[model samples]
Target: MFDRFIDYVAKVAPDKIAIRSFEGSITFAAMNRDINRLAHALLDVIDNSSEIVAVNYKQVHIHWMLLMALSRIGVASASVSSNSEIAEKEIAILQPDAIISDTLFDIDTAAKIHVLDLNWYDQAMKRFKPDPIYTLYEPDRIVRVSIAAGTSFMRHRIDYTASMIESSVIRMITQEKISWSLMSEIPRYPTLLPTLAFGSFHGFLCYLSIWSIGGTIIMADREQYFAAIAMLSPDLMVISPAQLQLIAENLPEDIPRQDHLRLIVVAGNFPNGLRHFVQQRLTKNLNVTYATSEAGVIASINIDQINHDDTAGWIMPWIDVQVVDDQDHPLTYGEIGNIRIKSPNIVQKFFQNVQDTHKQFKNGWFYPGDLGILNEEGLLRLIGRVDELYNFGGDKFYANKIDAVICSIEGIKDAALFSMPDNDGIQQPWLAIVRGGNFDIDQIARLLEKEFYNLPDVSVLWVNSIPRDEEGHVLRNHLEKLAMQYIETI
Candidate 1:
């Protein structure tokens, strides 16, 4: 798959920029040569053993090159980062045959496994020959494996083969009309919206689609979120909903040539506040997509529709989506139920997790654990997660409603609400909020009282900031701890 795109680009546009990072940029021809040399050097490391390797690298080029090299040898590649103890534990769980990283890890160095640092590997690969042999690998062999972030140890892994990768890119081009022509005078550059550690399936698909179209990938230090976008006048950008919040917060009053951005592709849950910000501030056309790590791209809704409708967008062409009840029977339109998707882009299996594999992957349908309604307009209006529903005195409600209401308030930046037992053992709602300004707790409580009558007693705590994972998801457990500590004092 890599060869098909990289080779074609190298022949037609050798000087075209393929990847640009903080350190420097590399051309298509040079990137292809480096991938070949790296693959040759990896042969010695593997020593004829067919094994999946875990690559934890800081550089964007290294991540792409390593994956390309591994694919050439028919070995699967899993990208991990040394971000947290949870991430480190997940990598250890993989027990990769070889751990190729820029920094040292705490895993046991078994004799069979090859552990090489980037500094040493870089020097070693320099002396190797650049002869790419893409024919050695079968298309059905697993090419990439990524885990769902924010799941902690439940880090469910999704395996993708070369054919899946190729098909996903094709879907992007045909379904979304995201294409680039060699005849066009304008340059098509795709800026990376997420870090390699997150390894979001949508982000990876965007990366592959951009490369397939011979477009340049612009990436920078993950820490320099706003600065990177300002520096690189990217034609297209793929960002997550969480990252969009960061962009909205950091946007300057006036940016030079900011209107040059043509498209902004967002994946994952779309919050109302984010939609409002994007619609009012950013002039670029917004494309909101609904996809899971298990399934590549399920559905999407573009700007005007997204701004107007409270749905995840229309289902993608050729995808079979069903809103089913507990019995797996399909529900009528406008009925809220569990969402199940069947598509060629769905992962074949969750590596090494038999229980999850059986529970989630059933009858060729992958249950995404989301509760939503398919409206008459054919749009999926996501209500909440089925598993996250909590009961208070036999009344069931999703915390997302609490979050949505609080976040929608004028003086609230972010908030999280979860059910917890009080001193009386009655389940009550507890809220933690990051103040956007001088928010009045009594006024907010009064507003919520109008929505849900007899709302359970809620304890509110004002915090400087809400803790979130790298993906921008609120860390519920961490917030619970803080709430507990405050409750103890009260």
Candidate 2:
């Protein structure tokens, strides 16, 4: 479905810089040629009737190239984690026809596998340069699959098709394109230097959306991101809250006023101080996007759109977002309940897992495991996860807000609110903190008092680090295990 778009861009601006990877850079025309060559070359290695191919390469740059090539062959593609254990789990769940990795294969598997090493691309190019046009894949056929991150030992698969991918790009880019200049100081094609990952859904969509307009992608490691920003003077930055914190920490005393940037912070429900910190140091033209893997960008808003607000922004007209009661009945506006979503991009259920499929998907609506409120004016306020809503001493503690407040304080690196039931089977809240120097632990009490007057007494557990997913979501299950281990040591 997207083949024509790539060909059009390659012809229109052949010399345009497409992607700048850690290894090197590639132009639109050259990248297009490589994609074509790789597609043709893979015909011999991958089975003709292959359904899924899991690519686990050390370099993310290689992952992007391989996935695109596999997509061209009308075979489903998934980015397997680099860690051997996680990669095994992902491959097991996918039950792919082929497994392609950069290292030697040792895990026993019945599927056809290949270890192509670092010189894989160079080898593939030498094999074939055929100029053959293949049939376009059906819009409904699954083209890509993403493994959802959480505390689960085995992650669930989120599948995507051409139609679903197109809807995501359209909702995230095309619809918002009209409101670009009117609402913010950013340009229509805000992709001068965007750090994107094709492994994740939103990151992939962000990269694809920018590519649709022939925008440049700068793929750098997390450590090199700040340096890349300083060097590139990026026009756009699509980053998570954790990444934003790193940026805030590394920025020099004299903040460069980048008036042209349109920084979009994903998975955000941050404190106002952190928001101000970003506007002051990074750019005032900031966009906080609240999104889910199943559904695309649900709601996003500019910094100046609201006053002292951390809302995900006004609801996107393309999506049906509702705050529903526990019984699946829709709640009235301004009431807090489960956030359920329905959109063209949404998959009704997980790819193969029946247990989670029934748990998360129901009656064509995807429950993103979030508790939130939708106001009458179409504004969405995400409180936290439904499972993270802890009741202690007759008071509720929002896990997201708890961490937001904790992490907002100076010298607090990362924080997560997790719980474990006592011997009496009563739930108790524990605040796992990864504190930096110069922050007093007592200040947490003062901050909690100001945020919630009737809050429960939350135990503070100091740890070296708090576990997190790629998007910076807290891993409660991990934290719980850590807490148990800490107790055993004591």
Candidate 3:
């Protein structure tokens, strides 16, 4: 399968620049050669079966090559991003046979039997023997593992066999017809600028898919992203909604230079006004929504289907979606309930927490804890999380609703709402605001009071900024701690 992809690259634009960053650019031949060298290095690290290796590296050129090499060499590898101590702890618990680090580390307490620094390995590969042949390679038979960031007391583990990966990939490609359709629809020369860390899923997958079709993958950092967008005038660009909004808000009005760009894909929840603002400003571009992870693409929205009022667009093909009640019974279209998904790309289970694995993985469906409704037109609209809804005086209030209202205010840049424990230890909803500039708190409170009559006791606090995880999900725990500090002071 991979050989076919490599061959396609060889056939179309063999000398095209495939990957680039602040450091430099690597042509298609150089990228393929680097993959070969990395594959050999991986083979050297794990000379025996059942050897697990933990890869600790940032999202760099070498890291991407290492991942592909590990997959090619049939090695079980788990990737952890920078400053992810929780991920490191989970990796230690897995007891991998070897740990690969990009820099020196004193993780003496880890259960890993051996440590291999990647810098040394890369140097060693340059002096190694004849280059390894570009042969067909499949994912290793070893079990896959992942951590569960759910509200559960214990973390969970995920395991998927090699056959499962192959089957899933094939099923997705067949069902979505991505290979054939994308080849015709996508531009002859496409480039991507992926956000580093686990969020690279979209850019990474698109890069690989484009490479499979013999296209280039342009690497971009914060500094070069703007300049490169103008210079390269890429056929396609994948970015988050937040980043897109920043670009739209920051760009000068008279620039008028991005007409060459064909598509700009944005993911994550977006405000309606901001979406409209972008659409009005960028008249010639096609906007798309594609949300993906290490697993695969979860959902997508096309430019034509984008409704400024709705957050997410249509569900992708091959994704069996349903809204379910608390008891897991399916809800009809237009009914608000928990969003449940059944797809070949969904992770089978958690790594080691058998109980959680069993509880969460049932009948081939994964409940992601998000609440949404499917309209009569077959469009999905995410409202909020199931647990993020709070009851006040027998009335229900959603955090997203409050946040939407607060964020719509002119001075407010971002807003977060959470239920905080009162003096009686009862959970009461509290509001937090991240402002763009100084504003009258009394006026803001009046606006909220008029809108949320049932939530009369809402307390407002000004925060420097709202914390978010790598994927842009609100860091509720951090917000709760900040709320506690604020309440104690008052």
Candidate 4:
């Protein structure tokens, strides 16, 4: 599969830079040689068909090359960023046969296996080059396992089989060509700014896809993302909606060529207010994408299709989407229900949690626990999480909806809404806002009163920062704990 991929790239543009990181750039030929050397080193450590291995690498290019090498060698690679001490704890629990590291790190374990240092591997590569051989692999075999950024001991397995990888490469190549074609049609360049970290699937996959097609991927830290926009003057960029909101709120008037950016691909939880803010501020459309760690990209809306503030778009050809109710009964069009999908791309099961694995799959469909409505137009609009909704005075309200409305306010930086028990021991809705100034609580209360009259008991609390998990999801449990403390103090 990799040979085929390399052949395709070689035919297109082999001498072009395939991987660029903070360290240096690697051409296609050099990257191929590196993967071959790594594969040989991996073979020396373990026989073929090794299920688990610890890949300790920080450079983005190394991660991609390692993934390809593992796929070719028929090994299930588990990658943990060097920053993760907790990941080491989980690695001890899994007890893989081999551990590959870019640098020597402290990992207290009993697994006696080869620890291939990347620096040493690179140094050795200068004097050795192996003959290229066509390697065959079982397309259905598991190739990669990615630990989730959620609670400890709960890992999300990513099984990138050969067939899945092939499909992914084809789709990405097609998308890249289409994006470039569109750029030519419009005569504009699309600049990519991906958020780093092992947990970011899109950030990892998109960068690899762009590199495979000889495109540039600009790497920047969280702060550097905004700084680059101010100084580097990119024509197009991709960012999460939350980051876009932060950029819009904190942008300076002297931002260089701010309007030059033609497109912004905003993914993850697409807050409605942030979409509106982007449209209003830049006078450009916001492209929202619905994607997941398990499944690559389910659906996406282009800038031209951002009408009615609805998630109306085509589902990716590779995805099989179904709307089902609480009882797992499939719903017809125009029905509002839970969204489930069946795709070879999604992980068949979680790494170690059998109970979650069973619960996540129903009738061979991966239930993501999101409630959505599929309209007659075949557009899917995610409402909220099935477990995140609350009933107030017999009226159902999604926490995300209230969050979007509160975050739409000019002064509010971030907001989260959840239910809490009142003095009467009845569940009441509460809104927490992370703001910069003295916000008028009474005025905000009146605004909520006018908009959400069904929510009779609404409380407001100012917080320094909204707690977020490593994957950028709002930690509702932490917010609930903080809300209880604020209630007691008041």
Candidate 5:
């Protein structure tokens, strides 16, 4: 479906730089040739069947090329990190026909399956030089399978169709006004620089969106991101709130301002005050995007909304968003309910899990496990997750609301609020605060009492930092375990 876009750029501007990494830059023409060679070489290792192929390589530069090659041949692809143990577990569940990586594993089942080391794969592809002709994949075929994070034992898969990938590109062009088409007056395409994991949906989409416009992607590790940005001067960037806070705290005053930069923050409810701080210091515009692995890029609010309004954003043109009740009945404006979505860009189903498919995908609408409300103007205000809504002695409340309020307090750098079971198996509200300077626990307790008059059995912990994943999501289960250990020790 997107073969035309890549081929067009290779034809029109063969010399244009497509990717820029620490190693070097590769042009559109060269990328096309390399992908063609890789696609042809892949045929020898994997069969023509629709079975998925798992790739766990250390060299991040080869991921995009491998994905394009997989798409070209009509085979679904799943990527895990270079950790052999995690790869072995995923291989057991996914049962991929081929496993491509930088090193070999010791799993007995892998002996029968084709295992192509990336170094060997590249050397072999070098043997097949010129473009190899191959049949294109159908639009409705599954091309990519993505895994969800925060699961220590189980890995859940979300399958993306070829049509869905194409639609995602179209949505980026139409909604973001980011493109290099002749109709656009903008002379240069945007360069995306992300510090997230390579296997993440956000990271993959960032690379794909840039490639769709024949733009550049600068690869950098989290520690090297700030230093690399100074040299690369990327026009587009995506980050988590944790990264934003890191920049706000440590960034030097003498760093050059990137006038062309457009920064996007994903996966959190960014307070308006912090949004202003980031825009003034880091970039010209700040976009807070609310989305999920199942439904990609649901909505994005720009600097105007970030400054003036309290909203995630109005629904994007690609999605049909609704606030529905438990019975799947549509709710009226300003009524808080489950946020359900219908979009062509969303995944059709889980790869092999029937229970998760039925739970998440229902009646053609994907419930992203979020609670929200839509105003009369169609603006979306996401409440906490329905599952995260805890009951304190018959009073229901969202933990994120408490977390946001506590984070707003003076001298509080970060906060995590959740319920933990006590000795009697009764769950109680607990607050963990990361202090920036001198913090008054008494004053915070008074504030909480003022907010909830009957609130009792509330405990507070002052920690240096909160436990979080690579994507900056709070690791609640890990935190709960730590809290239990702390309580027992005390």
Candidate 6:
């Protein structure tokens, strides 16, 4: 697994920093040693009884080390979060052969499941001599299990073989234009801050990409988002769109925008009218990307290459993207339909989730269930989800059609139009908005009337912020709940 890459990086830049947290930091050389020592310690205590090991903790280095250690011993690993709202449910579904977590947390599991406290692994790894006796690679064996980032909790397990993960990592390096060289002085992303959630798939990929080249991964979870940026001076920062909004809105006036940053990659869509402000406040190198848990990197476009608003950049050369009709046939260019992605490394099916696998994975293509359009030139534009279609007496259209028009109104920071059933059980349109200081609620009605066709009377639901998942998808259920509460209050 990572041991070989670590060994290679150690050979080149052993002295360079590898992982950094508030507690401490480790160099590539020392990290390699520690991983090997931990692998040997795990080798003694671990057996084939547990099919998959779940690594659950906030200790960044420890979590990472445990993952790589399990990989070295040819045992698959799943990154489980102790703080996940459905931690117990996740553990039950995973039914992990074993769980490695902090002793302070109580994660009840079956008596058959091995639960190794991190303190014990730490002590044992320190005392035992290290032997780098690890299987270098297993192409067919599953090496990692990443939970899908859909269906609210995104609990559906997605499995990856060693080859699939390697391919995905290489694709990331290629798409991100990561420079690789033997000369250590070139400084390849020396210090990095990734704003994606720690245990998420993209976050794991971010860490691996940085460590593949022996760069510093700053686990600054304890500090405020922008505060960490000021204190660490990271050369590269990887943020999701939601995190981008938080930093853009909350950053202090005194702190200067990061113009000197080597790169700033947004892992998901950049909302309409956001690029200009983000470029002015954050780094100008805002690399926009679109990816899925089933499908790997679908498309990526550098900020400089962008030519349109609300675009998901260009589809990857290796991937085939098509907007399809209801029957799963392809739709012509510029027409919005379900986005079906086909790539070499796309996951075959969900792990232990038969219903989802049947619905999503078919004939090497993964139907992500999101509405989107592909232009003739291969540019992708994402619309809302299939379940979000507004049914106006059986004439259905994606709700984002109205949203895209509504966002044209000035001072409207963010807006999502949702379909909610009225007291009579008829579906009605409801607008949830996060207004900027200069926005006018009345203006939304006026502008929407002019641009929209036969638009229904939209009830307004004012919210301080639009609730979204880490992936930047609007949490429509939460929005509807807020809307319901607002109706009750008024």
Which candidate gets the maximum TM-score versus the true structure?
2
What is candidate 4's lDDT per residue for 148-219, written digit by digit as tens?
432222445554566765666567556444433433343222345565354345555665555555555555
How are the candidates ranked when ordered by lDDT, highest leading? 2, 6, 5, 1, 4, 3
Q: Given candidate 5, what's the lDDT at residue 460? A: 79
What is candidate 4's local distance difference test score? 0.63
At residue 48, candidate 2 shows an lDDT of 74
Which residues of candidate 3, in runs, are more than 4 Å off? Answer: 1-13, 47-50, 84-95, 108-122, 133-186, 196-204, 246-257, 262-268, 280-295, 488-490
For candidate 2, the lDDT comes to 0.76
Better of 2 and 6 by lDDT: 2
lDDT of 3 by residue, 98-124 (tens): 766676556644434334556566685
Error of 1 at 433 (Å): 1.2
Go through the candidates in order and give each one's C-alpha lDDT: 0.70, 0.76, 0.61, 0.63, 0.72, 0.73
Highest lDDT scorer? 2
User: How do the residues 299-346 of candidate 6 rate in per-residue lDDT, one tens digit apiece?
Assistant: 877776666655677888889988999889998998978888888878
Error of 6 at 263 (Å): 4.4
Clash pairs for candidate 5: none
Question: Lowest summed-lDDT stretch of 10 residues in model 5?
Answer: 178-187
Global Cα lDDT for candidate 5: 0.72
Clash totals, every prediction: 0, 0, 6, 0, 0, 1
Candidate 6 accuracy as TM-score: 0.88
Compute each candidate's TM-score over C-alphas. Answer: 0.89, 0.91, 0.84, 0.82, 0.89, 0.88
